[model samples]
Target: MNSFDKLYYENYHKVYRVALKMSGNAQNAMDIVQEVFLSLFDKLENGGEIIYPGTWLYKVTVNKCCDGLRKQMRFATLDVAAGNEFHEVTIEKQETRQIIEKALFELHPRERVIMVLYSEGFSYKEISEASGVKFQSVGKTISRILEKLEKKLKGLNNDLY
Candidate 1:
């Protein structure tokens, strides 16, 4: 197998999932993943030095995700807030997930990307590298985003009952 093929096999899912979480849609995630691979191929052909393909893939995926988010903002997101209430707690939990997801969508694209990457177990240093942000900025950004998500989720949970 070619180097690109091996890289694709090992990291495609990671790239796609990061894209999905950042973009907040499965379809957009798939598109971003394809775009990332295409860009990788182009770079390879141009003799670009890729010391760490995984990191490069993530950077490309994030850039595509941000691009998609910008395009999406031209249209309004679906009102996921409008829904029926459930008597069962489990069903209520599902609805809470939906609400939290909606709140996540409302975050700034960069904050959303940081939170999603951090959630996926990427280190602050790795997130810094992938996002092209300074190492010190990673901690502050992540802290702010996580705090925002927590507050939003708490409010959403209160509203659900």
Candidate 2:
């Protein structure tokens, strides 16, 4: 396989997982992944060079997910203004994954992205680069997010019990 094909193979799943965590929807994650790769392809086609493809992909994927969330919020706001009643879909009881996902879903988009990137084992520098957060603040921000997640998870567990 060619170099670009090799790069795509190496990073596709990583990018998809990040997108999925950031967007909280499989379909939206798939679309974001496609858009990210398409952007890389376009840049390469036009003679752009990427020194670190993995880092570049992570940044682009995060950006695309954030953009998608912003657009969704706009429409959701409009729907709310129209007096639409939103229904809460019941999830299966006691599923750990669902509970964690629910907690993560409650986080701000940026916080979610930071937590996802950190969980993926990226160093503080990588997280900062991908998330646009300052390097010095990554650890502190992570600590805050962890506290929020822990509290949210405890609350969810209490609800279940």
Which prediction has the highest lDDT against the true structure?
A: 2
Q: After superposition, how far is residue 23 of candidate 2 from its true place, in Å?
A: 1.8
- What value does the lDDT take at residue 34 in candidate 1? 88
Candidate topping TM-score? 1
Q: What are the models' TM-scores?
A: 0.84, 0.81
Can you write out model 2's per-residue Cα lDDT over 1-161, one digit (the tens) per residue? Answer: 97678888899999999987787667777888899999998888899999999889999998888778777773111111111232333334325556777777777788888999998999999999999999999999999999898888888787554
Q: What is the C-alpha RMSD of each candidate to the true structure, in Å?
A: 3.7, 6.9
Query: Given candidate 1, what's the lDDT at residue 111?
Result: 78
Any runs in candidate 2 off by more than 4 Å, and if so which?
Answer: 74-93, 159-161
Tell me the deviation in Å of residue 145 in model 1.
1.3
